[model samples]
Target: MPKSKITETLLNSTVSKYRNLLKFCYFLMVFVVISCGNDTKSKVSADTNENATTETETEAPATTSSKTILFYGDSITAGYGLDDTNDAFPGIIQFKIDSLDLNYEVVNSGLSGETSAGGKSRIDWILNQDIDIFVLELGANDGLRGLPITETKANLQAIIDAVKAKSPSTKIVLAGMQLPPNMGQAYTTQFKAVFSDLASENKIAFIPFILKDVGGVKELNQSDGIHPTVEGHRIVANTVWEVLGPVLNSEL
Candidate 1:
């Protein structure tokens, strides 16, 4: 072979090998860059997921503890004639409290035909549970029965004393009552004064007359002419709420 032709062939082979080497290096760099990008994305996605999980694990639910309002009364508080006792004033008040998002539980500890003397006897048992607010609604039956005014007053006072002794912090709300004219002018007058006098003496909250607008109104009362109808109870709830609302709000 001629020397010039052999030299040209060798140079051509070397050039081809150098070009192939350059191409191989470019492909390896491109593969490494793509792999590194994919690994970075995976790490970022993993970090985001871990942060989300940590936040969810650390988060807590909100909770609230409910206080109690106890209505210690007679047939009026018991919703005697109503099909559902929820229509009673105490339950209506509970609905109002819930609507306002106030955390309070209303307990109606009323008994049908409960009188001042009866209330005095059973007060200790009712006081067994904690009472944030205590509403006393008695003496109406006593007045209706034409019982001795002095005895009724004494019984109610005893109940009040028992409550104070049991829980000094418990707020007492004295619900006043009045007797119909048939009970006698002097007797009725004395009965009406009983609640007011006790309230003043004890320095407690007082409802002048729990029945207020509902008492003498014929439409308000049920067939018994004594126990309030559902509508009547609603009105009574409003009257009670006027006084009770402030006390509850103060606690809040």
Candidate 2:
């Protein structure tokens, strides 16, 4: 063989081998890039699915199906001086409902310094929702303000009538309140009797003396001797629950 021909053959063979090596390197690089892209997409998809599942698990349960119990009243019913609203009677009532797995939602519509007249005006707006049990605890402010008994009674009757008119099937629970002897026997007696009269006349459920043993007790009441302490509210919860529990069971 000629030397030139042999050298040319060797050179060509070397060039072809180097070109093949470069092509193989390019193929390897493309494979790595494609694999990394697919891996990144898989990780993102898995993360998205995991996040969705976590959100669903932590979401709050819906309350649309629950029956609502509306607690309508003044500061005492509002849990005036309590640390948290949950520490109040209405909240305690809710805790009981949750514990018993009752299908009831307690709405604390108590306003501080609210009078029966105030409640009368707000009754339409408050009764706007679906109320299963309407717990009326008003007129305490009216009595405290030395408001006329007849006016207070009329206001309370109007509120009750409004609740009845809005939700006719709603069970009415009237919470009777009393004033101190400072308010005088005649007026206080009439104030106390007003609730009884309304309950009797309307044939509704009644909770006489909603405050019961909690009123005037130094420890049970706040320093103002008006609002109840946490412990006091606990007793009040029991007082209300006594009548409310039965109404709930029978109504259901």
Candidate 3:
């Protein structure tokens, strides 16, 4: 073969090989661009879905329809001296309610050393929430403090009237209290009569004594001899349950 013919043939073959390489590079670039675009779209879709789920969860409302039982009182109801406040009568009552699967929540609004007057002052604030049952145990501090029977009675009545004014349908349970003999028979007797009289006048549920079985019992009371011990709270819970159980059942 001639040298010119061989050179022409080599040139044509080289040109054809270069054209095939260019086509392969073009196809590879197209595939890379398509793949990158799909990956970006997939990431955006995932981010949008994630944001929608977060917004849905954040905007969801918490729906709970549990009735509240408010125990408004002093140290006895506050469970003073107990390591865990849940060991208190009101907390124990909550446990009982939970065990029975009742839709009632007990709020222990018992403050240490809260008297009738103090309770009267704050009762309005406490009543701000919807109360299914309101347990009144305020007078013990009044009696312990040797407050005037008339003033104590008046303060208690005011509290009762406030409760009635707040919600007429709210069940009020007045827990009766007794003073020690040291407070004098005349004063103690009058003080004792105050609760019963209020209960009768108001036509509300009466607890003859909040600490029926637990009060004055050396073993049941704590070292202070004022607040009840864990065992004492158990008995007190039973006492409260006797009246509260029926009231709650009536609601049901």
Candidate 4:
């Protein structure tokens, strides 16, 4: 072979070897970049899943338990003509219980136009459930209807006796009421006395008048002049709460 031709072949072979080496290096760099990219994606996916799990846990809510306090009465307790029952005094009391995170559930057993006699008839059935605190708000209807004061008093006493019989440990809160002067001064006086006398006799807690600030206030009452307005119920709730709060807190 010619010497020049042999040298040229060697040069070409060397250049080809260099080219192959360059190609291998380029492929290795690409493989490394692809591997790194895959690793990055896996890490990002794991981080996203972890964050989602944490968010789910953080967004969960809380729960409530069962025990009962009952408000038993006539239209006032029933929340007559109110837009929402919750806007009534009983409902307002319930909101307080919830806000305070107290364990007792407030039950409104108010019936529109219910008299003391009617309450006496139904109280036994009401006592069927265990009542922790009982608020008696009857007699207003009896007074309004001009029912016999003696009969009303007797019925109320019977209801109290029944409560004691059913749940001796149950705390009672009596709500007093008054009649307009037109009902006659003597009857009005006697009607008002019934509550004090009973409260003292039974040794139970008493609210002098559930409708103290609420009653006789034009804005506080509904159009009927009998049921209280939402604002009125708020005031009534405050009154009941004054007596009932201490009882509940002590009991709890």
Writing each residue's lDDT as its tens digit, candidate 1 over 25-79 gives 9999999999999999999999999999998878855666678899999999999
lDDT of each: 0.92, 0.93, 0.92, 0.92
Compared with the true structure, what per-residue lDDT tens digits does model 3 show for residues 193-225?
Answer: 999999999999999888897778899998888
lDDT per residue (tens digit) for residues 169-221 in model 4: 99999999988889999999999999999999999999999899878888999
Going through the candidates in the order shown, the clash numbers are 0, 0, 0, 0
Mark the 10 consecutive residues where model 4 has the least summed lDDT: 60-69
In angstroms, the error of model 1 at 148 is 1.0
| Model 2 Cα shift for residue 238 (angstroms) | 0.3
By descending TM-score, how would the candidates be arranged? Answer: 3, 1, 2, 4
lDDT of 3: 0.92
lDDT of 4 at 40: 100
After superposition, candidate 4 runs with Cα above 4 Å error: 1-65
Residue 50, candidate 4: alpha-carbon lDDT = 100
